[model samples]
Target: MAKQFENNMEECFSTSKGVFYLKSLSLEDNGSVSQVIKKRIEAINDENQESEEGDAFFVADIGVIKRQHKKWKTVLPRIEPFYAVKSNPEPLVLKTLANLGTGFDCASKDEIQRILDLSVDPSRIVFAQTTKQISFLRHAQKHKVKLMTFDNEDELYKIKHKYPGAELLLRIQTDKIKGSVNFGMKFGASLDSTKPLLQLAKALGLNIIGVSYHAGCLIAEPRAYRDALEHARSVFDEAKELGYDMNLVDVGGGFPATMEAGITFEVIASRLSQAVDDMFPKDVRVIAEPGRFYSTNAFTLCTQIISRRVVSTEGDSDPTFMYYINDGIFGSFRTLDFGYIHPVLKVLRKNQEIQDDWSGEKVYTSSIWGPTCSPDDFVAKETKLPKLESGDWIIWEKMGSYTSPASSEFNGIPKPKVYFTET
Candidate 1:
């Protein structure tokens, strides 16, 4: 067991960028995530005995990430996952994914540099941003990172002038779907523009390798992939007519990471794999840029309540409560503003005892706020929970996506510390 743990830890740290250091505990004998949270809270209490400081922190389960990757392989064996670094770029997460032999989808020079710093080969990265700065293009050229994407004529001209040798994928717009974040409003060229773009690339003596499209984030319909794949096939045929042998089709990301999402990863994978098998040949490479699929459920965030207030409405007999936590919208809960994720809060502890549930107990309607002064920095506008006092810990699961990387130290409140465990 010790040898296995050491080997796993070594694999996780092998590609470290040295941006941060982490100490991970290996849980054995059926240890639970709640147990890990309890242990860390106790350690924090012991260390801050005099200050009585109970700050926010994260407990990341690295083992969960490994399981997610394994599941991805089992379900979609043909397609490769190029993790969207913008999701959670935690060093441990990156290192683990890198060691798992997954590719990376980078949007900026910094993201590319970070992956390169991990000693990752430039071949494993795709500069997926449709609109990119010239400086970013130059950086990619300097690093010998050749694969990239472009959707507009200006981008083609920029690439022709800057990185002429870079391989390109033409990003096409997908049909607008409801109940998902529409990415076509911002990126992707229309179908009418696809042939023109291919013609333009050919005229400019540029290499157009394939097609790419994003169905949208949190896609509700699995058939969305089928529609997008059909559109991509048309682009591939157009490229073929333009004397370009496109051998790649990037089915861009919108995969659900949690069970609460509109669709399951398994359903999406099943539909997507069938589409790919139908549309493209075996020689064509297929890849995806998944942001939330791997990180969402792997992290659990814990925040400490610093203060509370009782409010009595004019007509209501019961009083509503307001609780302020150490972290907020400007910090870890930044995704709330964008409606990307809604975390379900669990009480880790209240009055020094573990709180599994509030069953049979009187619950109060409460509002949760962050430490920032911004009135909009609310975690939950209305929630029902047993009365909680200051110093109590609240756990938010499935918080690994779009949280830390987008967070800021607004109002000078420190970011949460992260602890790692493998169960």
Candidate 2:
């Protein structure tokens, strides 16, 4: 691929101070993922930085990097952030957040070890896994990791036998969002069963510290937090009655980002803030573990247009085309689950100044597929994009969340090419 047009706005674009998105490819002017990636990589090369061994990058310095550091006024003071490691698990994302003083919510021994290797203190990590693998339990206890959660009696027994003195938190079940993914039924103990578990922990001499719960992912209503907050308040009152001093409240992550519509962070934050102020005790250390909210919209996915195939829409009014990219379900795009219909952009032929209408207005029912041989290797079922041939790169914006860590090495299809982009 060659540089298609000379940029007259390159100077202004390059001088942008903080993290920016959607400033490239003035043709559609819709900000495609691949164009931003190309420009970002070019910038990195221009600065004489050696491209790392991997063809993939999250571009933290430009996007999440700016949000993590140097933008306290905009990011911090809004919400207390605890990064969910299962989302990306990459060292760059973990290390960057840790350096910014962000705490982590680790689910497994590996995730916990990775954080600790970065010198993230045990106190800064919540061994949030609801399940108690004996090895993970011992590791956390040995590391003096102060907090872990459980919703059942069997896990309490494991803790009692392996690490009795380990501090613990009871995961309370609450219905945060009605239609949201049911985090409660999956991992949490219902309100009725919790009292008996508290007794079991006491009998085993396990230390009970605090309580926590997750309202599910992509929470769209601010009232969702309020619903959970009210439940937490009741649970706290019960714990206090049980003669246990609870000082921590883990509001598990479900805070929605600027998704297509429905709910916004500011709205969710307002509700969460009010819930804490109203119900959460002042001394109760309030913290949230948000995975997608922080990193999702902050980054994009750039893939090469490897092949173009025609779609047969025999008598149908709408036409369809299939643009095969190098990324697949392994690319982490499937985690969106909530219909990720974001825009796509095309970077045209290199070495040419603006070709008059080289880009057409015609929209095609584009289904972007991955290069895997499996039938299930598709990324998007029916996406719309400008028709294109091989060599043109297509970009998917707001793909910073579960995309990378969720990538599978099935069939040995390499991960999609990655790059960072900002204004």
Each candidate's clash count: 0, 5
Tell me, by lDDT, which candidate is best.
Answer: 1
lDDT per residue for candidate 1 within 1-423, as digits (tens), equals 123244224233433245333333444312566777787677666855535346788878888888999999999999999999998888778877988999999999989988987788999999999999999999999999999999999999999999999999999998665445788888999999988888888999999899888888766777778998999999999888889999999888778775534677898899999999998889999999988889988888999888999999999988999999999999999988687766767885543556657988899999999999999998989989898887788889899988988999999887876667766
TM-score to native of every candidate shown: 0.92, 0.80
Candidate number with greatest TM-score: 1
Clashes of 2: 5
lDDT of 2 by residue, 1-423 (tens): 012212322311111122212223234222444455556445534647655322333332235544533432253353456788886665545655776788899998888888887777898998898897898998998898868898888898888788887778899887546645667668888888878887777777778888888888655566777888777777777777777878888888865556424776666666677778877657778877877666666666656667888867779986677777776665555554544323333344433221224335776778878777877777778856666676565555566667767767676766654343333
- Per-residue lDDT value at 1 in model 2: 8
Mind sharing the TM-score for model 2? 0.80
Provide the RMSD of all predictions against the true structure, rounded to 1 decimal: 3.4, 7.9
Q: Candidate 1: misplaced stretches above 4 Å?
A: 1-31, 47-53, 351-356
| Model 1: residue 84 alpha-carbon error in angstroms | 0.5
What 10-residue stretch in candidate 1 is worst by lDDT?
1-10
